[model samples]
Target: MPSDSDPRTDTTVVAAPTPVSAERILEAAHRLGLRYFVDDEGDVGIPWRCVVVHVIFQDTRAVQLRGTWHRIADTEHLAALRSLVEDWNATRIGPKAFLTVGDGGIVRLHGEITYPLDAGMTDAQIDDFVFTGCRLIVALVREAEEVFPDSLRGSLEP
Candidate 1:
């Protein structure tokens, strides 16, 4: 899924398949101050692993300041920052290989969410900067007998 040592994607924690619940996960995310970012079709970006829904929060985390949500973050949180960059890079340049969890089991690289980036943006600034840019990529693993189910079971794995 990766060619060359693109620093943005290197050494990133592989998105793993974790069994979890969606509603509770989303509630926790909101507690962290993440808002719902809906796509044109109105589907929110939620992460699930192998037929289980995990984190149900905005793919982008925005910070509220001065009567507006501004993209910002501390410089120390680079690991999480890199993941966002890699995800964005995969979307704009070409296909991305993500560790996907589905009913068929956990697999890497099938489909990816694409987007763009700005120069010299740090994780702190990225929160609000990325808020409006991401495409909603909800994860749903195929059930052995069902395609996709409404409302998954278990807690989200962050």
Candidate 2:
């Protein structure tokens, strides 16, 4: 028989997984002391130095953390940017990086990481996921800055 002080004698309580929701994601951001904004579409966005990380839910079954780098590249640089994105995606383990071209041939960079929460998640799991996503995306932006110093239009400080 185990004694009263034995480790096996202590009862452990397990927390049930909480349903995924925008409110829960916002709450996690709040707990991290991050400044976040809700868009007209109810999207939660956390602005970083040169990126805005958005937390979006997909039918409550998955969460996508997306970061948009606020730098513009001309169409002339499309080939180089595409090569960079391809190399980044090939070598990086997380937050798939990609490029988008808008009107007037403006090129933009984006990074995204997704987490499937089909079975829900505990508070600790949610917090860790949010934190990890943000860090990885930010790292991608920093690398972009290093690789294309003249591409940035605004200050990366903040």
Best-fitting candidate, scored by lDDT:
2
lDDT for 132 (candidate 1): 26
| Cα deviation of 108, candidate 2, in Å | 0.8
Please provide, for model 1 over 26-136, each residue's C-alpha lDDT reduced to its tens digit, 9 standing for 90 to 100.
443455465544457533443233321112223433121111001122333334434644654555542232333444332222323232222223333333223322222
Per-residue accuracy of model 2 over 18-73 as CA lDDT, tens digit each: 68888988899899888899999999999899899998888867889999898887
Cα lDDT for residue 17, model 2? 82
lDDT of 1 at 64: 15
Clashes of 1: 13
lDDT of each: 0.31, 0.84
Candidate 1 residue 21 Cα shift, in angstroms, is 29
What lDDT does candidate 1 reach at residue 61? 39
Report the number of clashing residue pairs per model.
Answer: 13, 0
- TM, every model: 0.20, 0.86
